[model samples]
Target: MSPIVVPSRLKLFGLVILILFLCFPYGGAAYSPHMASVVRISQIYSGGGNASSPYGCDFVELFNSSSVAV
Candidate 1:
């Protein structure tokens, strides 16, 4: 059986991809604490201002998912 050979263009493309991946910044497991989303939209009431709804205005409720005070 003959040996399998790879093309030079494919090898060059693979090397370029590797270099680009190594040169650019990627987001990993380590992230800043301030970058976390502490507050989130807990509830959204779009049925407001209707006849069956109790509230007369549409509102969005926000809740803090973290333990820190806002």
Candidate 2:
């Protein structure tokens, strides 16, 4: 039988780094991609005079810049 051959210190360090990288994986960023927002608030109106009331209800509108649903 042949004697067991031990890996060098540098090789061991590299192997440990590789294992850690595979286990953790860039702070888990590789699993989720960065989100890009295409939808934005277009208009808002509050405290406007309509007929007689001094304070009015607020209005909010949403606009989609992209063609795809987001």
Point to the candidate with the largest TM-score.
Answer: 1
The root-mean-square deviation over C-alpha atoms between each candidate and the true structure, in angstroms, is 7.9, 12.6
Candidate 2 global CA lDDT score: 0.73
Steric clash count of candidate 1: 0
C-alpha local distance difference test of each model: 0.84, 0.73
TM-scores, all candidates, are 0.43, 0.35
User: Would you list the clashing residue pairs of candidate 2?
Assistant: none
Tell me how far candidate 1 lies from the true structure as C-alpha RMSD in angstroms: 7.9
For model 1, which pairs clash? none
Tens-digit lDDT track for model 2 on 1-70? Answer: 9998777997899999999999987676443232255667899776566766566666788888878776
Across residues 7-34, which tens digit of lDDT does each residue of candidate 1 receive? 9999999999888888775833576577
